[model samples]
Target: MWRPSVAGPRGYRVVENADAFDIARIRPDETAVVVGAFGPFLKALRGIGARHFVLEKDPATLRPDEMGHFRPAESYPRIVPQADVLLITGTTLVNDSLPGLIACARPEARVVLVGPTVPMLPDAFLDRRGMILGTVRVADAEALHEVLAQGGSGYHFFGKYAPRIVLAQD
Candidate 1:
């Protein structure tokens, strides 16, 4: 369960995938730095005709065509600080790299922590200057459990059992 971190009007708003992108307000000319090889995010960015840079530790995660946008993780220090918008994968938290990544972003830049691994908690990220969280919500716990038991992944449970949602800080 989640609760507001502030009193009176809500500091965050719930939204769908597209709306979350809109909240970032990324322009075609502006560059967005993505900290992972998240395919869905790449697709959405392409759909909006936005230019972006992707950083990945593994080259295999990107396709031949996507290699043009790929940057090695070590280049983050030079690349991340220039981003107008930054989208970081939640896996960075588990790897203990999230703090360094966040520190690289400009204070005025829009930062979003994205992926199913992202927690619902807003206060924690808000304190780090994260402007939004893109995560999944399990609507049917039983169905999700069944899918996991069958070795099914996001492709099987998404939309039906678990749907994408965004928590945007105000």
Candidate 2:
């Protein structure tokens, strides 16, 4: 179960994955920055030729060939200011880094919070141009627990134990 730090009208709604989660929705002219090491995010950005930067705290998680693409978290003050779109992981919320991360975003940047841990509340998030939430709702709690216990990823549990959904502020 999750709780919100600040609450107000819930402005987000879950929808099917058809057009909602399109990473290409990002304009080709826009430069993107992903805050985590998410595989699908790279595939989507690459498909559209969006020259993007990634900031990952753990350099060990990246492949040897991919090391050049990831910047250390310490690079935020430099790299973040250049981004047109920012993709952040919801884990930032739990770790109490969300506020600082959001503060770094430029006024014109579109900030997106993604992952299962993304809060359902939309108050603080809505102040930005409406965050595109790439989240999931568990369809079977027990099955999801089992998958995690066995070291499964969202690629495994999606549609079986959890269904990936997109929520946007309206």
Best by TM-score: 1
Q: Candidate 1: minimum summed lDDT over ten consecutive residues — where?
A: 1-10
- Candidate 1 per-residue lDDT, tens place, 75-110, comes to 999999888889889899899888888888999888
Error of 1 at 2 (Å): 19
Please give, for residues 1-170, the per-residue lDDT of candidate 2 as tens digits.
12222222465555644223363278778888888887677778778888788889898876675576799977887888788888888888887877877778898887888888886555667667747776776789998999999999988887777776666655
Q: After superposition, how far is residue 109 of candidate 2 from its true place, in Å?
A: 1.2
For candidate 2, the per-residue lDDT at 8 reads: 27
C-alpha displacement of 53 in model 1, angstroms?
Answer: 1.0
Candidate 2 is scored at a TM of 0.84
What lDDT does candidate 1 reach at residue 115? 72
